[model samples]
Target: MLRNWQEVLDLLAIIVKIPAALIMKVEPPHIKVCLSSHSHGNPYEEHEMAALGTGLYCETVMATRAPLLVPDALADPHWRNNPDVKLGMISHLGLPLVWPDQNIFGTICVLDGRENHYSPPFLQLIQQFRGIVERVLKQIYYDEVRVHEEAAIRADDAKRVRLEFAAIRDREQKALQAIKESKQRWHFALEGAGDGVWDWDMARNTVFYSKRCLELPGFPEHKSLVDFAEWERCPHPDDAATVLAEVQACLDGCIPAFANEHRVQAGGGWKWLLTRGMVVGRDDAGRPLRMTGTYSDPQAGRSRLAGTERPPGRTGRHADGGIAARHGTDRRHGKDGLAGPPGGRCGPRIEHAGGQYHPVIVEPEGSHRGYLRARRRQAADGQRAGRIPAQRQGRL
Candidate 1:
């Protein structure tokens, strides 16, 4: 764009028969030659500057906002000592260029070394080119305004997006806090009830045991997590199949809840435990995702079923007594003939045989020692009774 303007100045100088033609710009206290004619003998160069208000020809045209012509600066007293005289440019013709806003931009002018009045034809030609320059300035000013407006709009959209994301983050933080608080309350309630708690995550096939739950099976209190395979090893071999089948039924939604009494291997022989649980969490397809349960000592309630004291001559005895007969004592007709609580009289008779403690039940007269021999035979034969095992025979 500026290259085209430089050509305009060059042609103007040739047609007007002048030594210099320039487009000058005002920058505060200085006036610069924005573009200078390319003709020979043209003294002014592009980008040359002179101090403003120094009686220069272009300065006068800008100050008055009109055309300026000087036939001979050496003859006119008003311009005789002007700075142009040093350049030997005595004759001048110039027109002021203004923006669309009516503000002075600069001057378009021609300067001559000889003293002669500029012709009207030359004056009209420069005036026509001045209109072209002002029109181009208008386009440049509008383009700058449009660019600034678009930048402002983009900044507003970015600010709105940042605010929306901040709002979403705040909501998620509140929800997580609420969930944490609820879990704390649930754990507190379960612990206070004196029940050992267990939580199973089906998706991960892992189980988490509370401190009390670990202690129930003679495990360390700090041991909290176990894999499914490890947990399956806890139940006694005789009871494992039934316990597992009951648990699977509940998980498959066939039963509303799981309640089973099973024997689990403990440090002190086998211990009977009552475990109750349900599917506490499920997926969208109704498949179990998580389960929670409690382990409780059921022996406390079964202790009352050990039977009341028999008559003086009567002995509570049955041939098909199964495992319960082996665990219970006949207080009336035994060799000791001691009448008292069932477990109190019968509990001390646990005999160490075949690598495990076998509880020997004292039957009626003539069968007391015979029953002991039979129990030893059963232990040797690896025969197991189906009734629930007792942790403490007297209490349960």
Candidate 2:
């Protein structure tokens, strides 16, 4: 746009046959030559400053918001001392430029070395050129305003999106942590119960077994159990069909619960297991979605049926599936058949050694008083059951 304005100034110089023509920019206390005509003998240069002196043509035009014309500076006493006269420009014509808001911008002016009157047509032409420059300035201002508005809107949207994504990520992390904690709690509870727990996803025909459940069937300790068929193979051949029938009855909603006594292969031959389960979850149409159960190895005293004397490393079972020594001697070598402290489920077991029945407390070392009290209580219970010797009765 400035290039086009410069071309207009050059054409003005050619049309008016002037030595100099300029487009000036009003900068408060001074006016600067923004563009100068390319005509020969033009004294003013582009970007040169002209002071706001009393008699300069551009300054007077801008002060009045009107045009200024002087046919000859020497002939007019008011303009005789003007700067243009000292520079050999004796004639001048200029029109004031204004913004759309009517603020003064500057002037478009022509200077000549000779005295000459500018025609009316030339004056009108300069006014039209001034209008074009004002319109260009207005368009540029509006374009910059639009660009700034769009940039502000984009920045606001980006900030909102970032906040939303951060919120979602925070929620996901919290949910994952909660799931991890829940799994740990469930595993702890199941292991503490000392029962072999199992879960069956009926819809997928998959089964899950806990560590205790795996040990009951004498399978190696593992974290996961996938194949239901493999679990079916653990039951003794004689009891498998009946157990399956009972479980199927419960799954079909024919029984209140799945309850069955079965034998499963164990570390010490087949051990009797009392298995119980129920449908814990159901689909919308009443089909069982999931089933959970427990395994109880009820053969604690079954070894007594083989003989009156129990072998070493073999745990003895009582009439009610509890552990007790009938041979006046009991010993345990591993994690099995041991309970710790009063808060734990497994109580102390009695061991007869060196002519006396000593109570074995499964707590940490250094519990002599508890052991003595347990022994006294065991002696009383055994004497009532007629299992203790009369000579040892005074030991209580």
Candidate 3:
């Protein structure tokens, strides 16, 4: 485009019979020859510059936003000392180029080496080219604005996408944190209640046991079972079949849940436990996907039934106290010589003596039924003798 403007300057210089034809561009403090005619004897060179405010020909045209004609610089006192004299181009005729918004671009002009008045035809030619230059400036300005607008639109789209991804990530993190906290709360609650919690993943065939669950079976706190089969190994042989059947029934949707009192091997003996569980998740085909449950020592109820209290100074003992008391001995000869199965289902004798009700262990030689019958007869005899209250007789 600049080469084409050079050609235009060359043609104008030839047509006007001038030594120089130039396009001057303003750059604040100075104006430079942006293009110069290639004609012979044209002293001005492309990129030649002169400081503004120095009485230059182009400066006057730009300042007044109008044409400038200097017919004879040496003859005019106001123009004789201008910088163009050093180049020996004293005759000047120029027109200002302006943008569509009327801002000055610069001047397109012809300069001669001798005194000569520029003709009307020459002036008309300079004016026509000035209009062409201003049109090109307008087009360049609008093109740059369009490029900047497109860049800004792209930047906004990128910013929106980044913000959307950030929002999604933040939401996911919050949801995961909530799930973790919920599990912690459930774990603390179950452990506080003295229950051993368990979770079975049917698809993975894996069983996860809580710390209490491991402790219940005399396993190390850090011990981990690999699968449900390993957990099944903990149940007593006699109870394993029944326990598995009850669990399968729940999994098969035959029962709402599995609740069974069974024995599990712990230490060197067996401890009776009440295990309750239900299928918590299932597939569309009704097959169990996950099961959760808890195991609790059932001996606490038996201890209460026998009117026993937790022994003083025995902190952290199981609520039952029976498991610890019967640990290294036969259940028949357990604490206080309690005669019963390992579960403590029966054989502890309750008697109202010394003004308080308490349990007394009966010898295994006596049948449970015979002992109850003899106690009833003794209670009736006491009532007849006025030794027992009528209200207490019913309790006996």
- Which runs of model 2 end up more than 4 angstroms from their true locations? 26-31, 49-64, 70-86, 99-105, 173-396
Error of 3 at 42 (Å): 3.1
Task: Score every model by TM-score.
Answer: 0.57, 0.45, 0.58
Q: Candidate 3: worst 10 consecutive residues by lDDT?
A: 387-396
**Which candidate achieves the best lDDT against the true structure?**
3
List the lowest-lDDT window of 10 residues for candidate 2: 387-396
Q: For candidate 2, lDDT tens digit of each residue in 1-396?
A: 888998898899999888898888888677899899999998888889866765677878888887888999999998999988988999998888777567777888889999989999998998889889888877876787789999988899899999999999999999999987986687678667656778887556678988878876667766356766666666554344345544555666666576555566676576666677777888787766788888766554342221122235333322232122233323322223332233211123223355322333333232323334445667878743222222111111
**Candidate 1 residue lDDT tens string, 50-122:** 9987889888899899999999998999988889888888989889988777878899988888897988887
Q: Please give the distance, in angstroms, between residue 173's alpha carbon in candidate 3 and its true position after superposition.
A: 4.0
In model 2, what is the error at residue 308, expressed in angstroms? 22
Model 3 TM-score on a 0 to 1 scale: 0.58
Q: Per-residue error at 37 for model 3, in Å?
A: 2.4
TM-score of 1: 0.57
RMSD of 2: 19.6
- Tell me the spans in candidate 1 whose CA falls farther than 4 Å from its real position: 53-55, 100-104, 189-396
Question: Across residues 170-271, which tens digit of lDDT does each residue of candidate 3 receive?
Answer: 999999999889988888898888788899886677788898888765677655545766776765543443455456556656677766665667776666
Ranking by TM-score: 3, 1, 2
